[model samples]
Target chain A: MLDKTLIGRESESTLVEVERGAIRRLADAVGDANPVHTDEAAARSAGFASLAAPLTFPGVLAQNERFRHSLDLGTRSLLLGEASIEYGRPIVAGDRLTVKTKVADVQERAGTSGATDVLILETEGRGAEGEFVFRTRETYILRRG
Target chain B: MLLARQLYFEAVKVGDELPPLVKPPVDRSQVARFCGATGDYGPLHVDEPFARNAGFPSVLVPGMLAMGFLGELVTDWLRGARVRRFGARFVKIVWPGDVVTVRGRVADRRFEAGGRYAVDIEVWGENQRGELVVRGAVTAQLFYSGDDETRQRGGQPPLVVTPAEEEERLAKLSRSTAPARPAVGTRPAAAPAKVQPAKPAAVPQKGAPPVPVQAKVPPRPEPKPVAKPAPKAPVKKAPAKKAPAPKSVPKKAAPKTKAGKRR
Candidate 1:
């Protein structure tokens, strides 16, 4: 059984520097040919101060070690059920964001195969000035035998 | 194309379909590049042996990658519109050689508090076989062509507009619809200067309800995070204040019972 006590556990804050190259690489890997993601001049022309990260770019920040281990999954087979991100502002290259995560909830529900325990995690990224930038909520299903 | 063409708030309709983006076949190299880019080096996505042990014929594609595809679909269609929210639910595993096609439709649109127009989009990705692999939504804030000048000036539009202008804009928006008809009829026939202050009150009573109804469509996933924290706040405080004494007692008793069972 998944531990309900893991709810509310928080990860130590990690600092992530949003790099221009990283944004370009992710956009390329996803086959998005939007030039604003790769060219600073194009981004500026599009009214952005710098290269704007893709809408799902925060998914990378959520993969840090501290955030991943905040809730111990043990040896359970894990599958991502849902992922959601809400942005307060567009993340741009050269912005340093402080990222922190917390286990929001855990519940067991009947699954297509059998009973499954759902783990909900919420992560927030704040800019250097402590302004909210984005938040991502990920739901993981831990299958039980 | 860099900026392509700008999308305006007034030009979009609720049922408009976004041009679908069909990706080439998923190959190992592409998945590997995605893994390196995102730093999600999960073994299930890269190691064929590990994937077989986990009960899959081949390595599975990362759900985040599928989400990224959907994100591209929305951003490309919206052009320069600012994405306020993007989310997805993984319905089935995607594997190498599967072609994913992303599609979206304009689900709703409304004027937000900041004097910006926002649109809600329903987006999804399906395999070549037409099975849904991921489904999601995107909420983006769009700009009117004239709003560029407002932004360059660094000022927001006034919170309240004159009743006549408000009514005219609403009528223009709903000229083809039914609910807005009644609100248009309520427009005061008196001179604009005379009814300016008094009519402002009536406009909101008629116009405000529908805006909220439209706003409610996109916030379905928000209530869980908003409501979960409230109950947790008290639980956190209670544990800090009085939990240690009781919790320690259980800790002490638990080991004793374990030792008794061992004997």
Candidate 2:
């Protein structure tokens, strides 16, 4: 198997722009049905700059190479059952964020179904001001079939 | 007022909710700002006309943006350790002006190959309607408290090696390091403003250098560049931090539990 440590790494830092249309589009996909998510007029009335994204916008900030850790732990299967997030601050449109992320850890567990591998990655999205705009700990559970 | 709370491995237990991470509602201006700043101009992010044509109730939130909120939660809880492995799946869309709160609870703790206790973490995004659009999990390396007691005040403490001393140690080991490899081409073009004035294509590397992908050297508008400037126009890129090994290094075993390391 290829070395998991080699792939369980990060690339150079890149900057990302948060556009408004994306927030509304993602809202539509989730069926949020909230006027705040889609209605520009509604946002204007609510005292906002433009349409905003739901609070989960930061979930996709940090990503890794696929199957980067399959051979690291001794598990062939990883299954995901539940996920949750707690917002420190609301996500606004037009925010320039710098996300620094890294491979946090990898583990194996014995379950009723079988052995599973869990990979944890962390990311911090800082705005221009260096304030804590957003942060997240993303996870991947690769189950051994 | 915001007070900082550090979640140590010894004090953590499964099902314990780290303090609630509250995010205000999203707005159009901020959404567009997020689009510009994040560089994820998927039309669906800011193009309202295109969105209506595509058939949807309203514009949707970027999945990665919502995840960024989760990243903030981890930083506060872990007190600045790198979150090793993070992954999430987009189940639902989040729109502007919707209040999405981040919430997570410890799931389990187990030792990795090196006796390092890996904390299983799960997080999600909830809208005003309390709907969850995204879910994820993570493992964090933390500094525990026991070590603090031993090293309290003035004593031979762990992590006490001065930077100069560490530099000396690293210098001694540098003899075994390999030579620099040739640069690789192929960085995306639409670059940000450069931090300093320099040749459009070249960058000087210091210690632990970065990939050439980070060095395309965005062409600044001015011909005469400033000296020793910070990299200008940093877009919000989620590159993993720390040393990026190649595809052949051996996987690390569960780290051994030291006296007070909390990761």
How high is the TM-score of chain A in each model?
0.93, 0.73
Model 1 clash pairs? none
**Using Cα atoms with residue i matched to residue i, what is each candidate's TM-score against the true structure?**
0.73, 0.40
Report the TM-score of candidate 1, chain A only.
Answer: 0.93
Candidate 1 docking DockQ: 0.30
Write the residue-wise lDDT of candidate 2 on B171-249 in tens digits. 6656566522111111112131221122211221222322211122354452222221212111123121222111112
lDDT string for model 1 (B1-263, tens) is 33225676655666566766667667788899999999987777888987667666777788888999898877767766788888776656777776677767666767656456677777766655444556677888776443443453476552433435655876886887766533311222233333121222232233212111001123233222221211111111111111111011111111111110000
Q: TM-score of model 2 relative to the true fold?
A: 0.40
Name the lDDT value of residue B226 in candidate 2: 22
**How close to the true structure is residue B160 of candidate 1, measured as C-alpha lDDT?**
33
Q: Which portions of model 1 show Cα errors greater than 4 Å?
A: B1-4, B147-263
